[model samples]
Target chain A: MTYCVGMMLEKGLVFMSDTRTNAGLDNISTFQKMKIWEQPGQGVITLMSAGNLATTQAVVSILDERTKAHDERDPSILAVPSMFQAARLIAKTLKDVIANHAQVGQRADSAFNATLILGGQIAGGPPRLFLIYPEGNFIEAGADTPFFQIGEMMYGRPILVRAYEPGLSFEEAMRLLLVSFDSTIKANLTVGLPLDFHFYETDSLEQGKTGRISADDPYFLAISQGWGEALKSALDQQPTFEF
Target chain B: MTYCVGMMLEKGLVFMSDTRTNAGLDNISTFQKMKIWEQPGQGVITLMSAGNLATTQAVVSILDERTKAHDERDPSILAVPSMFQAARLIAKTLKDVIANHAQVGQRADSAFNATLILGGQIAGGPPRLFLIYPEGNFIEAGADTPFFQIGEMMYGRPILVRAYEPGLSFEEAMRLLLVSFDSTIKANLTVGLPLDFHFYETDSLEQGKTGRISADDPYFLAISQGWGEALKSALDQQPTFEF
Candidate 1:
C-alpha cells in the first residue's frame, strides 16, 4: 500500500508520499512516488502516485519521455498552459498507458491501475490540486475539501478533516501532515517510514522542497512526541464517570 | 460495521462499543454489541462484538443460554474461574456457531464471523481483557498491550496508542476512548454514533457507569472541538520551505 496526500491551502500546495512498497510482509522496498516536472520560471508540477507501482512508474516514464522527445510532439504536464489542461493530459496519459499495457498483457483491476495527486501551477494560473482517479477523470480540491488523499488514507483522514484550514503556516501544516502519516505508519506495516515529498510555494514556483524523510527525522519525531503528549493530557482533563 | 474496544488497566477494565449495524450503506440499523453476564460476588463478564450481526447474535444467545442453564458441566465465560478460560470458551462458542450455521444453507465464505473484546473480573481474579478472534481463539491483553480494538479500528487507533497507560484515571481512559471512537466515526460511515458501553471496576463486579452515547452528547462535542483546534495549531507550527 501507499499514502499520498495533497493539501491545497490558501498559501500554496503541500504534497507528500511514503516510499515503502511491499509485495508481502517480508518483501518491502523503497520507491519514490513523487514525480516533478519543471520549466524554471514558466511552470512547475508534481505528481504523487499510489497503487500498481508498475503502472505509476510506466505513466511517469511515458510523460518524462514526451517532455524529452521534441519530435514526438506529445503533450506534457510542464507544457500544459492551465492546471485543468495538465490534469486532463495526465488522465489521458494514464489511460493510454494502462491501455497499452493491457493490450499486451494484464488488465486493470484491484491488483493493477493507479491513482495520483497532481498539484502545481503554471506561470499564468493559480495553484491547484487534483485527485486523479483510476478511470482518469479528476476533481480539483475545493474549499470544503481542502485536501485529497489516496491509498492507506483512512488512518490519516480524520486529522485532516478535523483540523485543516487554508491559513495554516507551512510548519504547522507539516506538523499535521507528519502526525497524520505517523498514525498511518503505526497502524499499517505497508505504509512505512522515509516519506518522499515536495512542497510547492505559491509563485516561488520551482520544483519546491524535496526530501527522503526518515523515522528519526527531527520534524517527524517532534510531531510524534508532541502529539502523544497532547493526547495523553487531553484525555487526562476529561470528566470521570461515577460508578 | 462497529467500533468496540476493551482495555485492561491497573485500576480495572473499560469496555465500549457502538450499536450501529448496516446491511449496506443505505440500510443501517442499530443493534447493541455489548453483553454482560454478572453473578454479583461470583463473576462479572462482558463481551463487545464487531462483524456479522447474525453470527455474533447467535453466539451471544447460546452463551446466554449456557449461563442460564447453570453450565458448570460445560465451560462458559461466566462460569470460568480464569479470564483466559473465559476467552477460550467465547472463541470456541463463536467457532461452533459459525460452523453450525455454515453447514445449513449459509454462504460458504459467510463473512459471518465476528471478533469480540471480552473483559471483566471474576471475584478472586484480576481484571482481564481478551481480543476474541473470528475463529473463536483469542489473546489476552498484556501489560505492554493493555487494549484491543475490533472493526473499522484503524482510523481511531492513534489516540489509544498515544494516550493509553497502565494506570490512567477512569475519566482519562474514557475520554481517550471517546476521542478514538470519534475519529473512527469521522472516517468510516459504517461505525457510527449512539454508542453503548460501560466500565467495570475490578471488585465492583457489576455493570458500573453504563450509558448510551449519541453524537450530540456534550462531553463528545467538547473533545471534538478541543481536538480540532489543537490539531490545527499543531499543524500550523510545522516548517515549510521555499522552492
Candidate 2:
C-alpha cells in the first residue's frame, strides 16, 4: 500500500512517495521508493514506484547495474537520449523483471506487479511526467491531466484535482503534495511517514532539490493539524441544509 | 458504480445516496438507491444500496412484495422485532438473491453482487446502523466507527473520519455528509446527482425528514463550490516545506 504522486507543472516537476510497505498487517516495514539518476548539466530523472517491493527493487537494481557497467554497449537510464526514452527504459526494465519472475510458473495475476511515476528534465526538452504500467507501457501527463498518482490514490485525489494549477510555484506544489499525503496517511494505516520528495526545475537539468519528511517533522505536523482544523472551520462556515 | 454513506450520531441516523448508475462510460443512467419502510409509531428502516443495480432492485422488490402480502405467516421486514432483526432480514434476502442468480452458472464475482447500508429505529430501542455484504453477513457501526460507506468510498472517507463526532447535531451531520458527497462527485464520474437524503431521529419511531438534491440545487451547488474554495484556501495557508 504505497501512495506516490508526480506532477508536471508549467514551471517544473514535483514528486512525492510514502515509505511504508507491508506484506500483511504484522509484517510492516519501511522502504525507499524513490530513485534518482542525475548527470548535472545533462539531465536528471526521478522514479517513484508502488506495488510489490521485490519486483520494483529488482527493476531498480538492474538499472543501477547497467549504469555502472564498464561496457559502452550496455544501455542505462543515464544513457537515454530524452525523458521519453528514459520512461521507455524504466518500463522495459520493469516488464522484464516481472516476466522473469512469472517464468517460475506463478500466475499472471501474481503479486509481482509494480507501477511507477517517472518525471524529470532533459537538457533540451521541457520537464515531463509519465505513469509506467506493469505491462511495460506508459502514458505521459498532458495539459488536461497534469499529474499521475499510483497506489492508494483516491483518498488524496479530490484535493489535488480541485487545487492543482499549472503555474504553481515549486513551494506551492510541495505544499499541495504534503496536504494530499497527509489526508492519505490519516485515512489509511498502510501508507505512513518518512516521505520522499523531489523537485526538478525545467532547464536546470539537475536533481534540483530533495528531502525526506518523517512523522515528527514540524512542517508535516503543522500541515496535518492545520488542514484538519481548516476543514472543520470550513464546514462550520457552509450554509446548513434546509428540509 | 454508486456512492452511499450512512452515519449513526447521538441525535439520530443520517443516510445519503447518489442516484447515478452506469454499465460503462457509454451507458449511464439515473436510478434511486435509497428505500424506506415505515410503520409510524412502530419503526422506520432506511436501506441504501451499491453494486449490481439489478440485484439490489430485486432485493428491494422481494422485501416490498412480502410486506404487502395479506398472509400473516409470511416473513417480512415490517415484522422484524428489532433493528438487528431488520438487518438480518435484509442480509438473508440479499444472500438468497445472489445465490439464486449464481445458480444459473454465473461467476461468484459476477456483477450480481451488492452491498448495503441499513439503518433505522424501532419502538423501545436506540437507532442502529449496519453494513450488509453480498454474502448476507453484516456488521454494525460501533462507537469507534459510526459510519458506513459502500462503492467508491475512499475519496469521501477521510473527511468523514476526521470531522465526525458522536454528538454532532442533525444539521451538522447532514452538512458533513454533503461535503463528503460533494468530494466524491467531483472526483468520480460514477457517483452523481440527484442525491437522496434521510434523517431518522432517535425513538421517533417514524421516518424523519427526507429530500432529494439535484445537480443544480442551490444548497448542493453551494457545498460543492464552498468545499473546493475552502480546500484551496487551506492549501494556501499551510506552511511551505523547505528542501
Candidate 3:
C-alpha cells in the first residue's frame, strides 16, 4: 500500500509521495516513489508513482533512457513542445513496458500494475498535472477534481475534499496535505515516511520549493497533536444526549 | 455502501451508522441501518449493519423473530443467560440465516452478505461487543482494536486507528467517529446520513444515550469545519525549502 497525492493549485502544484511498499506485512521495504527529471532552467518534470514497484521502475528506466537519448537526439523534456505531449510520452512508455512484461507467460498478483502522476512545467506553458492510468491513456486534472491520489486514498479523502479550493494559501494547502497523509499512515501500515514534498509556483519558471518530512519531523508532530486535540474539542462541541 | 462503527469503551459503547444505500450512484435510497433491542434495565442491544441490505434485513428479522418466539417455543434476547450468550445467539442466527438462503436460487447474491456490530450489555456482565462476520463466528472488540467498522471502512479507518482509546470521552469518541465517517462519505458516494448515533455506558444498568444527527446538525458542522482548519494549520506549521 502507498499514499501519493498531487494537488494542482492556483499557486502551482504540490506533489507528495510516501516511501513504503510491501508485498505482504512480513515483506515490507522502503522505496522512494518520486522521480525527478530536470534540465534545470530548460524544463523540470517530477513523477510520483504508486502501485507495483517493479512495473514502475521499469517504466521509469524507459523514461530515463528516452530523456538521455533526447540530449543526443532532439525532443527532450527540454525539448517537448507541451506538458500534454510529455504526458503522452509517459503513457506510451508505461504501456510499452507493461505490454512487454505481459507478453511473457507470467504476471504478479493484481498488484503488478502502477499508477503515475506527472506534473511539470516547460519554460512557457502553465504548470500542469496529469494522472496516468495503468493503461496508456491519461486524464489531465480538471479544476473540479484538481487533486489526484493513488494508493491508500480513502483515509485522506475528506480532508482533501473539505479544504481544497483553487486559491488556498500554500501554507493552508500543505498543512491539509500533511493531515491527509497523517490520517493514512496511522490507519494503514503499508504507507510510511520520509515523505517527499514539493511546492511549485504558478509561474516561478524556476524549479520551486522542496521539503522532506520524516516520521519524526517537527511539522508532522504539530499537525498530529493539533488534529488529536481538535477532535477532542470538536467532540465536546457536539450536543450530547441524556443517558 | 454503508459506514457503521461500534466502539467498546470503558464507559460503555458507542455505535453510529449512516442511512444511505445505493445500487449505483444513480439509484440511491435512504434505509436506516441501526436496530435497537432495548429490554430496558435487563439488557440493551444495538445492531448496526453494513453490506447487502437484503442480507442485513434478513439477519435482523431472524434476530427479531427469536425474541418474538420467546413465548411457549423459545426465548432469544429475553432468555439469554448473558451478553456473551446474546452475541452467540446473533452469531448462530446469522449462520443459520445465511445457510438457509444459500440453497435458494433466487438469492444467489444473498450469500455475498452483510457484517454487523452487536454492542450492548445484559445486567450482571460487562458491556460486551462483537463484530459478527458473514460467517457464523464473531470476535469481541479488544483493547488493541477497540473499534469495529463495516462497509466503506477504509476512509474512516485511519482516523479510528489513531484516536481510539478505551478511555476517550463519549463526546470525544463521537467526534472521532464522525471525522472517520466524513472521510468515507467524501471518498465513496455510497455512505450518507441522517446518522444514527448511540452512546451506551458500561454497567449503566440498561438505559443508554442515543441521538439522531441530521445533515444540518450544528455540532457536526463545527467538527467538520474545525477539523479542516486544524488540518490546514498543521500543514502550515511545517518547515519548507532550505539552501
Candidate 4:
C-alpha cells in the first residue's frame, strides 16, 4: 500500500508520496512513487501513484520511453499540449497496462489496477491537477475540491479538510502535506518514509523544489512529534464535556 | 456505514457510536447502534455494533427477548456468570443470527455479517472489553491495547492513538470521543451526527451517563468548529519547511 497526495493551490501544485511497498507483511521494500517529466521553460508534469506497483511503473516507463523515442507511435507525456491531454495519456497508459496484465491470465483483475494523481503546467495553459482512475476516467481538482489523495487516505484526511487553504504558499503547503503523511505513517505500517515530494509553481512551466524525506529527516520528525502534542493541547483548550 | 469506539480507561469504560444507516447512498436512515443491558447493582453490558443492520438488530433483539423471558432454554446474556461469558454469549448469538440469514439464501455471505464491541463489568469481574468478530470468536482489550473501533474507523483513529490516556476522567474521555466522531462525520456523509455514547465507571455494576448528541448540540458545534481552528494553528506553530 502507498499514500500520496496532490494539492492545487493559488500558487501552484504540490505533490507528496510515500516510498513503502509490500507484497505481504513480511515482504516490504522502498520504491519512489513520484515521477516527474520536465521541459524547462516549456512544461512540467508530475505524477504520484498508489496501487499496484507493476502497473504504475509500466505506465511511467512507457511514458518515459515515448519521450526518448520521438518516432514511437505514442506521444510523450512531456510533449502533451495541455495538462488535460497529459492526464488522458497517463490514464490510457494505466488502463492499457492493467488490461495487458489481465490478458496474461492474472487471476484477479483488481490485482493490476492502479490510480494516479497528475499535476503540472504547460506553456500556454494554466496549472491543473487531476485524479486519474484505473478505468481511464479522470476528474480535475477545483475550488470545491482543491486536493486529491490516493491510497491509505482516511487517517490523514481530516487535517487536510480542516487546514487546506487555496492561498497557502508552497512552504506552508509542504508543511501541511508532511503532517498529513506523518499521521498516515503513524497509523499504518504499510505507509512509511522516506517520502518523495515535488512542487510546481504555477506558470513557471518547470518543476519547482523536489526532495526525498527519509525516516530520519529532522523536519518530518519535528512535525510528527509536534503535531501530537499540539493536538493534545488543542483538545485541552476545547470546552470540557459535562456529565 | 457507521463509526463506533470503545475504550478502557483507569476510572472506567467509554463507548461512542454514530447513528447513521444506509442501504444505498440514496436510501438513508437513522437507527441506534448502541444497546445496553443492565441489571442494576449486578452488572452492565453495553454493545455497539457495525455492519449489516439486520444482523445487528437481530442479535440485540434476541438478547433483549432472552432477558425478558426468564424461562428460555438458553441462558440470558444478563445471566452470564462473568464478563467473559457475556462476551461469548453475544458472539455466539451474532454468529447464529448471521448463519440463519445465510441459510435463508442471502447471495453474499458478507451481506449478513456484523461486528460488535462489548464492554462493561459483571459483579465478580473487573471492567472488560472485547471485539467480537462475525466468526463468533473475540479478542479482549488489555493494557497494551486499550481501545477498539469498528466500521469506518480509519479517519477518527489517529487522534485516539495520540490523545487517549488511561487516566482520563469520563468528561475528558467524552471530549476526546467527540473530537474523533467530529472528524469522522466531517469526512464521511455515511457517518453523521445525532451520535450516541455511554460511560461505565469501574465497579459501578450499572450503566453510567448516557446521551445522544444531535447535529445542533452546542458542545458538539463548539468542538467541531474549534478543532479546525486548533488544527490550523497547530500546523502554523510547527517548524516551517525550508524549501
lDDT of 2 by residue, A161-219 (tens): 99999999988998899889999999899999999998888898888789899999998
A197: Cα error in model 4, Å: 0.6
True-vs-predicted CA distance for residue A138, candidate 3, Å: 1.9
lDDT of 1 by residue, B114-206 (tens): 888998888787888888888777888997788999989888887788778888867777777888988888778898888877778878877
**Model 2, chain B: what is the TM-score?**
0.96
- For this target, which candidate reaches the highest TM-score against the unseen true structure? 4
- Give DockQ: model 3: 0.40
- Candidate 4 docks at the CAPRI level of high
Candidate 4 lDDT over residue span B92-184, tens digit each: 999999989998774794899999999999898899999999999999999999999999999999999999999999989999999999999
Q: Residue A123 of model 2: what lDDT?
A: 82
| lDDT (Cα, tens digit) per residue for candidate 3, span A1-243 | 899999998888888999998988899888889887777666778899988788899988777776777455444544687789889888887787777777786765555678899998887788889999888899989887899999988878876887788897677777778888888887788999878877877766666778678878776887777776665454454455222
Worst 10 residues of 3 chain B by lDDT: B234-243
Question: Which parts of model 1 are misplaced by more than 4 Å?
Answer: A99-109, A237-243, B69-77, B106-110, B233-243
Interface RMSD, prediction 4: 0.6
List the DockQ of the predictions in order. 0.43, 0.79, 0.40, 0.92
For each candidate in turn, the interface RMSD (Å) is 3.1, 1.2, 4.1, 0.6
Cα lDDT tens digits for candidate 4, A64-140: 99988858946877778888999889999999999999888647949899999999999998999999999999999
Query: Model 4, which residues run further than 4 Å from truth?
Result: none
Best by DockQ: 4
lDDT of 2 at A37: 89
DockQ of model 2, rounded to 2 decimals: 0.79
The segments of candidate 3 whose C-alpha lies over 4 angstroms from its true place after superposition are: A70-78, A107-109, A168-172, A204-206, A230-243, B70-75, B99-111, B158-172, B205-207, B218-243
Q: Write the per-residue lDDT of candidate 1 for residues A66-168, one digit (tens) a residue.
A: 8888887557667888989999999988887777777776554556678999999999889999999878899999888889999899888888888777997
